[model samples]
Target: MIIGICGSPRKQATEYVLEQALATLREKGYETTLWSVHGKWVDYCTHCDYCLTNKECVVQDDLQELYALLTGAQGIIFASPVYNGGVSAQTKAVMDRMRAVVAADKNFFKGKVGMGIVTGGDRNGGQEFALMQIHTFFIINGMIPVGGGFFGANLGATFWSKDTLDGVKLDEEGFRSLKKTTKRFAEYIERYGVKDGGKQS
Candidate 1:
């Protein structure tokens, strides 16, 4: 399955952007799942070493369910609204809390395909930097990071949301990036991901 993690705290541009990305994957005959952090109480990871030994997160919260979803997904899309030139705290929390999941099985995400989507209020508002951050995490987690390549989506799907859903919808250039990125994302999954009800090792 292809899973999208929407890190927006509201039902706004970030969610819409991820929705479109997931829709593109669905069109390619891939099952998609979207998880939004809106109004969800996901506590921050304190770098606690409990998981290092226990192999599970000690703090029980909304992120527990996400762990399983993320583990089962063949492809992952991390979409976040730009906050202070970076991903929202919610997104960071989810990323940080994965320490335990990794401790449980070091190769939990090995060979998985991951991508990022960042939405900014203004053009070139640290979107690339935020995308880098997500890609960095994917690399560190042993997942393969894919991008749409040159042209519009040099790093991944980027949108100028102007902090509004309608504003993002009007971003024609952004849609081009989204389309290109999602197309690449789907293609990668088809080539490397599980098939015929078999999982990739």
Candidate 2:
């Protein structure tokens, strides 16, 4: 199945972006699911070694469920709203926690296709840096990171709150550009998705 992952702290906008990405994937005739990683208080990794023996993390928190979702996804849409010059602490924590999974299964995420999306507060916000942060995680996990066909997939950082995300939009143009990027991402999946490539690396 194709899964969209939202790693943002703002639940509303992240959900909206994730919904659109999932719809794009569904329109391309793929089964889709979305998971938001900001629902609970997820802690950072503590360098604990329990994962080596238990096949699980030492920190008992939300990411345990996220780990399950990761294994089930064939394609992933990873979205984050930029904080400062990169992904938020929430998203980074999830990425750091995932190191345990990489350890448990060295090739756990092999062949997975991943795309990046980010919303910034201003035009010159650190959109590209945030996208690189997400892509770096995907690459370290052995996943292929994808960008848009028409243009790159960096969503102009958003200043619109949940209340203004839809109706009278302030960042609509940027979001529209991001939509094109996400659509291209969906098309890329349709073009080169590997669903039956055997077990993950």
Which one wins on TM-score?
A: 1
Task: Please list the residue runs of candidate 2 whose C-alpha ends up more than 4 Å from where it truly belongs after superposition.
Answer: 150-170, 196-201
What are the per-residue Cα lDDT tens digits for candidate 2 across 1-201?
A: 776767776566656766766786677787887778755768988878788887788887877777877776778777777678788887788888887887788777787778877766556567778878888887887777776544433432233333334521456665666677766666655666556431534
Residue 126 error, candidate 1, Å: 0.6
TM per prediction: 0.95, 0.84
lDDT tens per residue, model 1, 112-188:
88889999999879898899999999899888798898988989988997878999999999899888888888888
Q: Model 1: residues >4 Å from true position, as ranges?
A: 194-201
Alpha-carbon RMSD to native, per candidate: 1.7, 3.0
Clashes by residue pair, model 2: 107-201, 119-157, 120-157, 120-158
